[model samples]
Target: MTDEMLMMAVKNGDLEKASELFDRYHKPLYNFFVKITFDRDLGHDLTQNVFLRMIKYRASFRQDKQFRPWIYQMARNIYADHFRRNKMLFSDYAEVEDLKNKIAAVDEVMVEDERQKLLYISLFKLQPEQREILILTRFQQMKYEEVAQVLDCSVANVKVKVHRAIKQLREKFLELEKI
Candidate 1:
């Protein structure tokens, strides 16, 4: 069944369809979570939490709203919570060091292709929100509407963010001089 049908079933307390939807979306969502968090165990735990949240709130879900956004919102929450906990655990210097490693890993993954490396190198300098907009828009191929939904923002806001991110990315690329 389609997500809509399955969601309706879930809302109506149909255990079977809810189980199917849970199983279907679990892996891809987990992978997305893992890539963003860069922590496998956290991703696994967050994935479980996301599905559990869905199950817990199944009856209250709006039928017109898309499940994808709902799940992505849960992921965003999980990510934010993790970041918060990490911030409290580490001293400023340690957190900076950890971020440096994360940034290096991000660069390695995205810059492997020499041609694309310039693009990512430039983008890396932007604010986190701008960088996130670029990743969700340019790399993920998410439509502005869907992205806005995932981000819990307006479509116009998403567009502005993407446009600015692209402009800044270009500037960064030029500053780096392709080397």
Candidate 2:
């Protein structure tokens, strides 16, 4: 069944279908949280929360809408709530030593290459908004239209943000390479 069908089943009280959705989305959602927060344990928790929220707020699910963007919107809200509750500034959270420790704990496959490690380090260095846009558009491979829905912005705005983020990432990656 398609994700939308599974989600529709979930919304209609056939809760067992949620497991199929979970099976499909857990890894990508986990990786999304890990990439954003640099904390594997927290990623696991937040990803679980997304599914829980979906079940709790099932009534809000509109059958006319695509499931992927809707779930992503929920994930973004959950992440925002987490950020607000922690009251952490990006500078405070992105400490070099702390990031290195967290990144070291990330899955080996994601960090096996030296260049890939450097790229992630660069990603972590970006402003939170820039980092998120890149993760959503590039890493998650969400199309511009889906990203626009997830972000509640225009496709043109998403494109502009992506372009600027790539430029920033490139500069950060180059700076990291020099060190």
Candidate 3:
């Protein structure tokens, strides 16, 4: 169903309509959660939580708002809760971590070189804030304004971050070659 139709159904408090909406949104939100949290199990749980929040508050679903941003806002809140409960401890990131590490593992067989594996590893070392911009814009193909909404920043800020993140990624790979 179209978003407006979905909203109308939701407004009517129809459980089946809520089910359809959750099914429609599950995968993209799952991918978004994984890119941020770096844990498949946690990502799955968080995606479910997002849908639950939507259903729990279906009466408040806005007719004018795009469902995407509303769902993304749900995701952002889930992420914040995780970090808050963790006592803000991303305390030690000793090496290349989660998303980049997993992507590099897949490329290990395809690329056929230690050098490129090292380069992929270097990409993760960029600040998490920067990496997130690339994932949302480059990987997810989100528009600048949508990305800005997800990240809670301006469209110009999202564009600038994507540019700078790419530059930094390149610089990091080059520096790795020197090591």
> Best-fitting candidate, measured by TM-score?
2
Per-candidate total of colliding backbone pairs: 0, 0, 0
Best of the candidates, lDDT: 2
Worst 10 residues of 1 by lDDT: 88-97
Report model 3's TM-score to 2 decimal places. 0.77
Model 1 has how many clashing residue pairs? 0
- The order of the candidates by lDDT, greatest first, is 2, 3, 1
TM-score of 1: 0.72
- For candidate 2, write residues 1-179 as lDDT tens digits: 99999988988889999999999899989988888887778889999999999999998998899999999999989988887787774323556788667666654546877777888888877887898899988888999999999999999999999999999999999998888
Model 1 lDDT vs. the true structure?
Answer: 0.72
Q: For each candidate, what is the lDDT?
A: 0.72, 0.87, 0.72
lDDT of 3 at 50: 90
Who is ahead in TM-score, 2 or 3?
A: 2
